[model samples]
Target chain A: MKLLFSNEVKEHRFSLKCIPHDTDMQKIENIDVSVFPDNITGKDIDSHGNITIFGYTKELHDSFGFDVEGTASTGLKDFESAKELHMVGMYKYQTKITAPGESVLDFSKKHSLESCSSNEEKALLIMQNLNNEFEYRQGCTDMDTKAEEALKGGCGVCQDFAHIMLSLCRLESIPCRYVTGMMIGEGRSHAWVEAWDDNRWIGFDPTNGKVVNDEYIKISNGRDFRDCLVNQGIFTGNVTQSQTISVIVNEEQNLIHD
Target chain B: MISYMDICGKRDRVEDMEIYTGADVVNEQLARYGVKFGIYKNNEFKEQLFPFDMIPRVIDNKEFAYLEKGLKQRVKALNLFIADIYGEKKIIKDKIVPEEFIYAGSGYLPQCEGIVPSKGVYSHISGIDLVQSKDGTWYILEDNLRIPSGASYPMIVRGIERRSAPSLFTGKHIEDNRNYADMLRHTMDYVNCGGHTVILTPGRYNAAYFEHSYLAEKTGAHLVSGHELIVENDHLYFIDYSGRKERVGAVYRRISDEYLDPMSFNEESVIGIPHIFDIYRKGNVALINAPGNGVADDKGIYYFVPKMIKYYLGEEPILNNAPTYLPYYDEDMKYVLDNFDNLVLKDVAEAGGYGVVFGNKMSKEEKEKFIAMLKAEPRRFIAQEVIDFIDIDIMEKGQLLPRKADLRAFVLMAEEPMVWKSGLTRFSRNPDSFIVNSSQGGGFKDTWVLSQ
Candidate 1:
C-alpha cells in the first residue's frame, strides 16, 4: 500500500507580533510533500533527521497558517534488521534518561533486562511495561510533562510513552532513540523508539505497544521528544498564541514504487 | 619572586610605576571604554565595571613557553576525546574512562552524535584555568571548553593600558595581545564553509555581553542576534539593518547550546533562531566551539583527561590536574569522607563560583547536610586539594597586598592548537576568598608574557 500524510498547522496570535518566521515541520525523504496557499518557499532537511520548510515574510502578523501533504510509498517488508550499522551506533543512543532518572534504572533492574542478550526481547519488554504502566490520557499531560511526571501520574500521550520507553531501553544499554513519524492510523502526530541491535535499527511503538512496520513513515529521529520536536516558534509579544495542528495519514493504493 | 618589576628592573619599574600608581585614571578610562559586565545577584540585575588592576601579572619567557605547550597538548587530547566520544567508543569500551562518567554526565548530549566537525575539532576555543603553587608548579584548575569568554578582556585592555602609560611598555618587550582578534578571525575562517562569518550574541544582558560585542568589532564580523539570523535552504543567513540578508558560513555563537535553536532545544526561547541548528546539521555552516563540548569539560571527566592525553596522543600529560577526586569512585569517596576538613568541594553542574564550598569553613549542621547531599548524589560533586597557592601583589589603597589569583589561558584550535601568549589573570579582592570569577568580588590584572 501507498500512503498520503497531510497536516494543516494554524497559529493564531491575538496581538500583532514581530514575525520572526518559523519552518520546523519536516518532509522525510521517504515522502514527497506539497504545501497549500503557496509562497512558503524554503524547504531543507536539518541536521539530525527532519526537513525544515520556511514561510519567510518577516512582517508582523496576527495569524499564520501552513498546509502540508506528503505522499509516500509504503510496504510491509520482513522484520529483518539492516546489514551493517555505523560505528556511531555503539553508544550514541545510550543517552541518560534524566527526566525519570533513577526510576528508569530501577525499572530496568526490576525487569532483569540485559540488552546484550536480545534487543528484540528487551525492546518489547520495555514497550509492554510502558503501555501497562501509563494510560493514554491526552489532556492529562502537556508538552512540558517530563517522563517522571508522566510515569508518576500513570498518564500521558504518545510523547510520554516514547520518552518512558527511551528511558527504560537506555537504562538497559539498548541504544534506543526517539522517532517522530506517522503510522498511517487515526492520530495527531506520533512518537516512537528505534533500538539499535545486531548492527541495525528497528522501530518499536510503545504508545500502541507493538513493533513498527512499513505502515510507519519516519520524519525525524533524536535522543528524545525534545530532540525530534515537530514544530517550534517564537515571536516578539507579551501575548500568547494558540496552535491548531491536524495530521492525517491516509492509504493510497495506486502510488506504489515502480 | 617572579614579578614584572624584575623584568623591567627597578629603574624602569619606578618610571612605569605611573601606570600602576594611576589606577583610578585607568579605571575611569575603562568605564568610558564600555568595559562593563552584567551580573544578576539576589534577583537584581546590575551592570558594573569589571575592575582592572594596573599592576600586571608578568610571566617570564621560559615559563610561558612551557604553559603554551601544555595548553596546546591538553586541548588536543580533549578535542580527540570529543571526536572519539561521538564516533567510536574505543576509549569507553576499553575502560580508560568509565562509561558512567560519559553517559550519566549532565554535560553529554546524545544529539551531538554522528557530528564530526569540518576539522574534527569540537572545542575550537578552550579556556583552561590554571594556578601556580608556592613551589612554582602550575596546575590546571578547570577546563572550560564551551563558549569561553574573557579573551577579549585581555585583548582590549592591553591596548588601552599600554596607551595609558606608553613609557611603561617602552623598555619592556611584552608579547602583543592584539593578535587575539586576528586569531579569532582565522579560527572562524578556517571552519568557514563558503559564506561570511558572524558573531552570534544572545544580547547585552548577558554576563560577558561586552566581550561578545567587542570581539565582533575587533574580528570585523557581523554582530547578530537570534532575530537577525534566519535558516533558509539549509543555510544560515544574517539580516542586516537595511533588511538585506547575507549568507553566514560560520557562527561564533555566544548563545548556550540549550538556547541556540527553539525548534531543536528549549522551545520557549524567543531569543533563539528557530532552525539555525538545522543549517549547522546539514553542514551549511560551522559553529565555533561546536555544541556538545561540555562532556569534555565535565568536572567528573576532568579526572580522566590525563588518561585521555595518554590514550589519544600516546604521550604523557605535561600539565597536571589540581589533585582532584570525584565522589563517584569508592576509594575517592572514602578519601573525601576521611579528609573532610582539608578539601574544597565543587558541584559539577554549577559555574561562576556559585557552587563552591570550603570544607573547613562549613559549620557542623551545614557539613552534615552537605555530606547527605553528596552521599545521595555522588556524581554531582568533586573534591580538590586546596593549594596554598602563591599570592600576587595587587595595589589596593596605594598599598600592595597579596591576593589569590588564577590565569585563564585562551587556546584556539584551528589547524593546530594555538595558545594566546597573554591570559586573563583574575584575582579575588577579599582576603579569605579563593574564587576569582568576575561575578564574585574580584579584579583582573593584565597578564604580560615577557619577550626576553
Candidate 2:
C-alpha cells in the first residue's frame, strides 16, 4: 500500500489491517511487516481478532507506504466450541452497510427465504442468487455504498457482493459475517461471507458462486465491510491524497514441487 | 421529613433568607468563573450562563440514604452489564437481553470486544437521572453512563454559596458537597496504570468544557487536548510545553468514544490521538468510564436494566424505572397504539431532549404519520406513561415558581460504588416544559443532603 500527498504533510498517523492472523482454517507463518520512514510501529489485535499495525510519523513527508509479506497455510481445522464464539451474535444483526432496503427486502421475499430449512442451505441459495444477479464490475459502487444500493445498481465489486449476500443471509436468520482476504488468482484483496451453521463457520464466495477452499486465504472477518478496512489514516494536510493497494498470493507447494 | 427552615431553626432561617435574596450576587461570581455551557443552534455556537437558583433542593437524610443505596446498586449492575456485553455475553446467552438489542444499537462498538478495561471497571463515573413524581415515588429517568456532565455545575455553585452566605453552612447540617473532587480523584487513582493522571478534553468549545477544566483543576490532574498527547511504544504520553514526555496513566476523557481515537474508531476525527485505543487495549493506560459503555445506557436497553440487576447481581431493583413500553414487543405495541394519546414517545437514538414528543401535543395528521413511523420501525421508539412530577419551588424574579425538576446524581466507582452526597438539581425555567437539560435553557440548583 502507498499513500501520496500532494503537499508535504507532517503528523501522518495511519493504521493498517492488512496482516493475516492464524485462524481456524489458516495458519500464518514467517510474517514480516515494514512501514515507510522507518518509524516505530505497534502491532495489536482488534476486537475481531485481526492484526492491526498502527504508527505515527511526526516528520514532514510527501509520500508514505507499508509492505506486508507472510505465508498462510489454509485448510479446515477443528471447529471452535460454541461457548467461545463471543462475537458471532453481532453478525446475526445487520450493519449500516449491510442493512437491507426495499430492493433487498423484495429480493429476499421473492426467494421466500423464511421457508428455508437450514442456515447453510439458506446461505448457499443467497450466494447463488447474488452471483447471478450482480455484475462483476468496478466504479459502480464505492466503499460507502450500501447493499441495497449496490443491488439496485446491479453491479459492484467483491465488497458489495459480500455485503448483499450478508444482508440476504441475515434476513433468513442465518448468522453470517463479512471476510476480507486474498485468493490465489486475484491480484488484489477480496471480500466474501462466512455463515455460521450448526457450530462451524462455512465460507462462501458470492462473487464467484463457490465455497471458500484452500486457495482462499482469510485476513480479517467482521460483521460487514466496515470492520475489514485494509488501511485507514488521517493527517494534517489539506492537500489531496491518493492511495494504491495490491495483494499477491502464491503457493509454496507449487514452487517446491516444481 | 423536616423542612429546611425547621432544621435550621429561626435564627439560621433569617440568615438563609439573605442568600435567597442574593441570587444575583451568586450568579455574578459564577459568571466571573466562566461557568457556562455551550450549545449549537443552526450551526452557530452559543455559550449561555447556566442560571443558578439560590434555593437548594433539600433531601432528607433518610430519603438520601435510600437514594444512595439505589444509585449504587444501579451503577454496579450497569457496570456488570457492559463487561458482559464485551466479554462473556452471558446476559445475551441467558436471554435476559435479546441479541438484536445488543447489536442493533449504534452504541455497540465491535472494536471493544474481548477486552476488559483497567481494574475491570466500565462505568467508572456514572450519572443516573431521577425524578420524584407527585406520589412521592422516585423513578429513574435515564442513565448517562458515558461522559455524564452537570456535576461540576453544582460542585462549583456550593463553594460560591458558602462564601456568599456563611451562616447557611455554619448553622445547617448539610453535607458538604465540595468532596466531589476527592471522590473523582480516588476513582481515577484506583484504576491508574502507574503514571500521571490526566483529563482529556476535546477543546474549549465543547459543551462540558467548564466541567472538564474545573474537575482537572480540583483533582490536580493536567488538562490536555489530543494534539498534546502522543502514543509511542504501545503507551500514551503527554507532551508538556517544555517538550518533556510525561506518561499518562488514567485519562478522564471528556470526548465521545468514536472521536477519541482516529485509528480505532472514526477515522475522520481530527481531534483524536491515533493508536490510543491500541495502547488502551494492551492495558498500558486506562480510559475512565471506558469505551463501549454506550451499549448499556442505550434507551432501548434501558427497559432491561432492572432485569439486568436481577440477572447479574440477583437483587431486586430498589428504584423504579418510569412505566415504559417498547414497541418492539407485540403486547407493548398494542398497548401503545391503544393509548397513544396519553403517553410520551421518545426516539431511542436521540439524546439531550431532542427526539421527545408528547402524544397529546401532536396534530391529528402528524400523529397519524408518527404512528405509521412507529409501526414501520418498532424498535426505534419507546412509549412511556408520563410521570406527573412534583413541582419544586425555584425563586425566579424574587417569587417562588413551581416547575418540573430532576436530580442527576453522580456515582464514582472505586473499590466500591460511591454515591456523592449532593447532585445537580436542574429545573426547567419554562413553567410548562418538563425537559430540564442545561442545553434547553434550564437553570440549576444545589441538592443538599441533610447530614442529620
Candidate 3:
C-alpha cells in the first residue's frame, strides 16, 4: 500500500490489518512488516481477533507506504466452534449495509429461504441464488454500497456478493459473517461468507459460487465489509491525497499438484 | 410528597424574594460567560444562549435523599452492565440481555470487547434523566452514560445566582452545589493511571463547548483539543506551545467514542488523536466514561435497565421506568397497536428529541404509514405510555405559565457512587411539548436541594 500527499504532512496515524494470525484452520509464519518514515509501532487485537499494527509518523513526509509479507498453512477445517456461543445472535441480525430492503426481502421470500432447516443450508441457498443473479463486475459498487442496492444493480465485486449473501441469510435468521483475506490464485484480497452450522463456521464463496477450500487464507471476519478494512489512516494536511493498494499471493510448486 | 400546591406556595415566597428580581442579571452574567449550546438547522450551525429561568426546582431534603439513593444504585448497575457486556458473555448467556440487543445495537462497538477500563469503572460520570408525574412519582426517562453535558450549566449559573441574590439564601437553606467540580475532579483522579489529567474536547464548534471549557476550568484540568494531544511510545502526551510534552494519564474525553481515536474508530475523524485507543487498550491511560458506554445507554437498552438493576444488584429499582413497551415483543406490539393513541413512540436509533412521535398527534394517513414501518421493523422502535408529568411555573413577561420539565441528575463514580446535590432542570418552552432538550430551544433552571 502507498499514499502520496500533495504537500508535506505530519502526525500521520495509520492502522494495518494485513497481518494474518494463527487460527485453527490456518497457521501464519515468518511475518515481516516494514513501513516508511520509521516510527514506533503498537500491536492491538480487536474483539474479532484481527491483529492491527498501528503507528504514528510525526516527521514531515509527502509519501508513506507499507509492505507485509508472510506465509500461511491453510486448510478447510471448521475452527469457529471454539468461539463463544453468544456471537450467533450478533451475526444473525443485519447491519446497515446488510439490512434487507424490499427487493432483498422479496428475493428471500421468493427463494423460500425459511424452508431450509439449518443455517448452513440457508447460506448455501443464498449463495446459489445470488451467484445466479449477480454478475461479477468491478466499479459498479463501492465500499459503501448496501446489499439491496448491489442486488438491484445486478453486478458487484466480492464484497457485494458477500454482503448480499449475508443480507439474505440473516433475513432467514441464519448466523453468518463476512470474511476478507487472500486467495492462492487471486492477485487481490477476496471477500466471502461464513455461516454457523453444527457449532462451527462453514465458509462459502458467493463470488465464485464455490465452498471455501485450502486455497483461501482467512485474515479477518466481521458483520460486514466495513470491519475487514486492511488499511486505514488519517493525516493532518490540506493537500489532496491518493492511495494505491495491491496484493500478491503465491503457492509453492512443491505444494501444488499438477 | 412535593405537590404542585407546595411548589406554588414556594413560588409565592420566591416572588417576594430578591432572587426573582435578579433574573435579568443572572442571564446577563450567563451570556457574558459565553454559556451557549450549538445546534444545527438545515445544515447550518448556530450557537444560542441557553436561557435560564429564575424559578428553581426545589426538592425537599427527604425527596432528594431518596433520589440520591436511587440514582446511585442505577448508575452502579449501569457501570456493571457495561463491564459485563465487554468483559464476559454472562449477561447474554444468562439471557438477561439478549445478544441481539448487545451486538445489534449501534452503540455496541465490537472494538470495546474484552477490554476492562481502569478501576473497572465504565460510566465514571452518569447523567440519568428523570421526570415526575402528576402524582409526584419519578420515572427514569433515559440514561446518558456517554459524555452527558448540562451539569456545568447549572454549576456555573448557581455561583452567579448566589452572588447576584445573596439575600434570597439568608432565610432559606439550600445545599451548596459548588462541590460538583470537586466531585468531578475526584472521579477523574480515581481512574488516573499515573500522570496529568486533561479534558479532551472536539473544539469550539461542538454543541457543549462551553461546558467542556467550564468543567476544565472549574476542575483545574487542562482543556485540550485532539491536535494538542499525541500518542507516543504507548502513552498519551499533551504537547504545549513550547513543544514540551506532558504525559496525560486520564482523559475526560468530551468527544464520542467513534471520534476519540482515528486509528481504532472512524478514519475520517480529523478531531481524534490517533493511537489513543491503542494506549487505552494497553492500560497506559484511562478514558473517562470508557468507550462503548453507548451499549448501556442506548434508548432500547433503557427498557432493560431496571431489569439490569435487578440482575446485577439483585435489588428492586427505586425509580420506575416510564411504562415502556418494546415493539420487539409480540405482546408489547399488540398492546401498542391496541392502544396506539395513548402511547408515545420513540425510534431507538435517534436521540436529542428527534425521533419521538406522539401517537395521538399523528394524522390518520401518517399513523398508517408509521404502523406499517413499525410492523416491518419492530426492533427499531419503542412505545411508552405517555405520562402526564406535572408542570412547574415559568415566568413569561411577568405572567407565570406551567411548562413540562425534567431533571438530569449526575452520578460520579470514584471509590463509590456520589450523587450531585443539584441537577440541571430543563423545561419545555412549548406548552404542549414534553421534550426539554436544549438543542430544541428549551430553557433551564437551577435545582435546589434543600439542606433542611
Interface DockQ of each model: 0.19, 0.68, 0.59
Off by over 4 Å in 1: A1-30, A39-98, A101-119, A129-139, A142-144, A155-157, A183-190, A200-202, A206-209, A213-219, A234-258, B8-20
| Candidate 2 vs candidate 3, DockQ winner | 2
TM-score of chain A of 1: 0.75
Indicate the TM-score of model 2: 0.95
Model 3 over residues B153-196: C-alpha lDDT tens digits? Answer: 89989899889987656767789999999999999999999899
Tell me the lDDT of model 2 at B428: 97
Interface RMSD of each: 6.5, 1.6, 1.7
- Tell the DockQ for candidate 1: 0.19
Error (Å) of candidate 3 at residue A177 is 2.3
lDDT accuracy of residue A47 in candidate 3 = 70
Residue B395 in candidate 3 has what lDDT? 77
| Shift of residue A116 alpha carbon in model 1, Å | 11
Q: Which ten residues in a row have the lowest lDDT in candidate 1 chain B?
A: B10-19
Highest-DockQ candidate: 2
- Which candidate, 1 or 2, would have the higher DockQ against the true structure? 2
TM-scores of chain A, one for each prediction: 0.75, 0.92, 0.92
